[model samples]
Target: MDQQMFCFQCEQTAGCAGCTGKKGVCGKSEKTARLQDELTGALIGLARATNGGTLYTDDTWKIFIEGLFTTVTNVNFHDDTIRELMGRVHEDKEKLAPMCSGCGAPCGKTGDYDLSRLWHADEDIRSLKSLILFGIRGMAAYAYHAMVLGYTDEELNRFFCKALFAVGEDWSMEELLPIVMEVGKYNLACMELLDQANTETFGAPVPTEVPLTVEKGPFIVISGHDLLDLKLLLEQTEGKGINVYTHGEMLPAHGYPELKKYPHLKGNFGTAWQNQKKEFAGIPAPVLFTTNCLMPPAGSYADRVFTTEVVSYPEIVHIGSDKDFTPVIEKALALGGYTEDQPFAGINGGRTVTTGFGHDAVLGLADRIVEAVKAGDIRHFFLVGGCDGARPGRNYYTEFVKQTPEDAVVLTLACGKYRFNDLDLGTIGGLPRLMDIGQCNDAFSAIKIATALADAFGCGVNELPLSMVLSWYEQKAVCILLTLLYLGITDIRLGPTLPAFISPNVLSYLVEHYHIAPVSTPEEDLKALLHEGE
Candidate 1:
């Protein structure tokens, strides 16, 4: 098939539809896109092989995760690596159901389903399945991280197979829509598992003030959300004359006791993932990615980009299972960073950013928050957070955070906060008006803090004076959205624009039932979200 790829799996898809040229808006090339599709098809076969009565081994679960997680928007971009994963999926399926391969009378029951069939399916059915597929890709990232630390859920793994098998089936909108929601339901459990794993392995996060200044001398920038990898790199580089800095989602590593112990773990670098193309240009340090949200590198700094775990780019050096970051350390040493300290600031020009306010930190002040509400000192709460993209309209978050009531608290996480996290929002009721939660998966922490507040106030979550203004860009945001909807949370404001994959009927269903609305201007949305119940 001589075809340009068609992938609309992210918010940055071309023309709000699919990427239909040599490269996607995210910089994924045509060859890489096709490999991702082939990988998805093989995963479908592996899922089908686990049907009705097949024995699902531990290896099967790991391969299942690698297969689904690799196709995420920016996780992997190497054709060889993707095809290698596809081969593993098929090998696993053949091992489980031997008759399905190379038999004189082979069965069609466990054959790979062509992913093109999905792209060509009816619009409504395709939308529903896309939710299931993209949502799982995001969930798999969280699951993979948890698994690295010895956390796994049987139900979660089983649901992975069920969802993938549903993707391959000739299911109608009625059948697939619920499975789509089920992806959200299971993703909540998945996130909870990862949270437990992270907090247990690294200790609970605490409030820590991290500077934005890059110190003189050699340093390495570690991006992505694998705390274990960060910990290893920090330990490996300690006393080795190379400083380390967290970038993007890895910024929260500073809060963990195990990670914060390292003195060389110096402040953060760059803003959100979308800014990497410019931020990493001609940088004299090496950047390592440990999870999702990887934009392809430019020729100027491509040599300095190193991918570990499942993240890959065509010719980039990949630190494989060994996790020996000698290559990255050597690169950093060779770059010989800035001769003098280089001062950096967020988009707001704030010289420093703060994080580590996980659930324990926030809920510790639950009584005070309740009292402030009763005393009318803190009037409302806004969870203005999600992924950030290069799209033109994402400035709504910046303006919304800027225009929030002085007495309200703005809780944020993920890269979306890079837009406004640097702004000085001051304090309300002895707590900073703006609080930075951990990674996107740390939305579990936000949910926990919200439930605690509602419990303290003797009210349901919706009845509390809280509003969510989220900006979504990828599959992780999708699963998080689904989890919110499944919990019966109502009246969410999602923008810069709604998902293109969501059909009109499906979106209307969400609107009528959940009261979901596209965000308007900050002034308009703020007034409605703040004063509507009153």
Candidate 2:
């Protein structure tokens, strides 16, 4: 049977194949997904054209970033938005390829390649293209975040084009392998740009313990990836009886000095992005999503959902380009919160978790960490973190952290830490055994800390006593995964589900060369890891 249309660039696809026929698991339709692919293909063609010595303007980079961001998980659920973006990409491609106008000789070199060719290619090629596509999709989110803060890097912009064009080329493993690394190399720059933009604009995040309790009276909850939206919410709601609480990826905001200064900015209200449905239900507060990871709103909480920036869902209130958050504020006041301070604990029953331990925070304590390691007090370090989702097997993270030896320190970041952050793992060498290193974008911090540790010990990153056991739910995780691969850091354990988009052959290649394994039962995997340590 002929497959319908698709846009399966996510971990969760229909039937573990791809999103075919009508609607995706996240409610994106076949036509919209195909249009998104078309947009990506056109961006790739523009990238190829630019690589042929044609200079691309800053606007070109903006279009490239926006196009990629639109296709990320749960970002744009509307077909009209996808179609509009596809048109914009087509217009940009025309502007870049203007001279190829009506050349009768069929110059295939200049026109946009159909994305279906990639979808139908050999498994290896498809996997590599998927890597490039997914990598850029992830990078775009970070770039968008940076751009909103008025920080943009030209080299990072150029690499987006370079990497996208490579996906369309007939490259093999020998040729594509370095480009895969280049994705990581460029992502480091992208992440650095975002890190600088965020830290400079918001000030460095300090160690802060945020409560999960919802205080009495009116309060607003902000979710998704955009800090600007959160800031605006804080600004608009300032001194207004309404309070603001972080949700999903926004939890890291509590660590930022500028954001934490908001007297009305309360604490985090829930765990991870996947738990929004149950968590937000009857919460009596409006939730604003500034970027991706927005599921289709259940009818019960449908009216409370407000979206801004690039995130959109049909019929939800949208805070537009002007960035006015009046609607969200009003919703919060209307749904007045509990009569008393309603205390909420984390999944593990802890009142709070320490965050803001980014690379700077950890590297500042490098001497202590090194001394502890040399003294044999800290035997190993495990980076057990990544995105969290609703998949059944995700308990492996909780078990993985639970099973870590007392001599090992567990460093985590992003929403994945919610799985085990609340677990009161005692201190090692006077440092907390469980360190929350801010948001998923802060994976750059983990990379920096690992590199510095290796430099301190005069060894390669893989030679150090660090291990990465990551869980992925979306494209941001995809880019970070690629970053690790690019650094030649091997022996990664990825779970709870291998991406349905990765083909068998591609999976085999990663397994054989990179030693990337899937999560087994935590007991078995922990024993194997301990055996390796011995």
Candidate 3:
């Protein structure tokens, strides 16, 4: 059969390989996937046109970032919206290079790149370029979040253009490899930029306990990673008697002082993005998706689904540029939340989950942590974090965290924590055994905490008793992995499946240099990670 679509940029792609059938594992139809590719191609074309002498302005950078973000898994599934984005990209390109449109023999220098070439290229080249492309796609998400908060880096903007331009070039492995690594370098910068934007804008997050109960009356469940949306929703719903509970990535918003100050911003609503289908189905409140990880809504809750920013679905109400969440508010009020307080619990049966151990919060406890380690009260540290999904083997993360030794501490971030965030691991010294380190972008905080611990002990980060067992589902996790590699952190175990985009040659190189390994059984991997038999 002829290939209808090809996508492997996500972990749960069909069967550990590319999704090339009529629909993707994430519910993206073949039509939507094709438009996403075209949208990507158009962005590359714009990059090419801009490289031909037109400098990247704020407008250009915004379009480029949004275009890339739109193609990320579960971001935008509407073909019309994707086509609209392609139109905007093409319009920007035409404006930048007006003469190219009219030229008769246009040499194909500034035309939209045909992605099939890259898709069908030699495996190693495809692998290296895929790293660059997907890495920047992930980084664009951070950049987009930062941009919304008025944070823009010239260097970061320029890198997007440079990387997009390289994707269209027929570069060799030697030529593309540096750009691949550079994606990691710049993703670190992007994550840092987002960290600053979030902390500075929302106040440094403090350790905060969030309940799982849905308070009586009208309520809104905001999901995805946009804190700005949550803030606005809180503001609009303040006097309206509607409560706002975070779902998925937005759960960490409770740790921010500015966000937490809102009395109506009650608690977290669901476990993880993967559970949204089941959890949101019967909820009495509307769910607003502000970014990716938006699974197509099941028919039960389809009407209650609203999208904003780059997240779009056909026929779903989209809160547009004005950021007016009025429709979402009205939907919440109309739904009329649970009549009485409805209690919910996380996957591990705890009624509350704690978040906000950002760099500042963790580093504030540096002295106590260092002393505990020195006194041998803390035997090891495990950074078990990343995206979560519905795939079967994902239970590995829950089991891995479950099997952790008592003297060890587990630092988790992102939606992956839903696996076991509610488990009562008790305390180590004066701190909780399991620490929630904010969102995926807060991987910077994890890096800071690890590096600080290593610095206090006078050893490299790798030499510290730190191991990262991550579960990845999408592009954001890809860039975070690159950042970890960029920092020279090694012995990382990534699962539930190795990326389908990673070619054997590239995988071997990562194994040889970074010691990156696919996650095996929780028992066996834990034994190896702890050096039990070595």
Clashing pairs in 1: none
RMSD (CA, angstroms), candidate 2: 2.0
Clashing pairs for model 3 are none
**Pairs that collide, model 2:** none
Best by TM-score: 3
Q: Cα lDDT for residue 421, model 3?
A: 95
- Tens digit of per-residue lDDT, candidate 2, span 1-534: 146576666666766567777787777777767777777777777777676425666478888898899889889887776777767766766676667645544545467778888888887778777888898889999999999899998778878877887888888877877787788888888898899888888887787888888999998888887887888888888888998888888888888888888889888888888888898897988999988789889999999999888887778888889988888888888889778998898898999877888888888899999999999999999999998877678888998899899999999988989988889899887988988888888888889999999999999998998888999878888889888888888999998878877878778888998999998888888777766656
Sort order, TM-score high to low: 3, 1, 2
For each of the candidates, the C-alpha root-mean-square deviation to the true structure, in angstroms, is 1.6, 2.0, 1.3
Cα deviation of 327 in candidate 3 (Å)? Answer: 1.6
Q: Compute the lDDT of residue 73 as modeled in candidate 3.
A: 87
Residue 27 alpha-carbon offset, candidate 3, angstroms: 0.8
Compute the lDDT for candidate 2: 0.84
Model 3 spans > 4 angstroms off: 52-54, 104-108
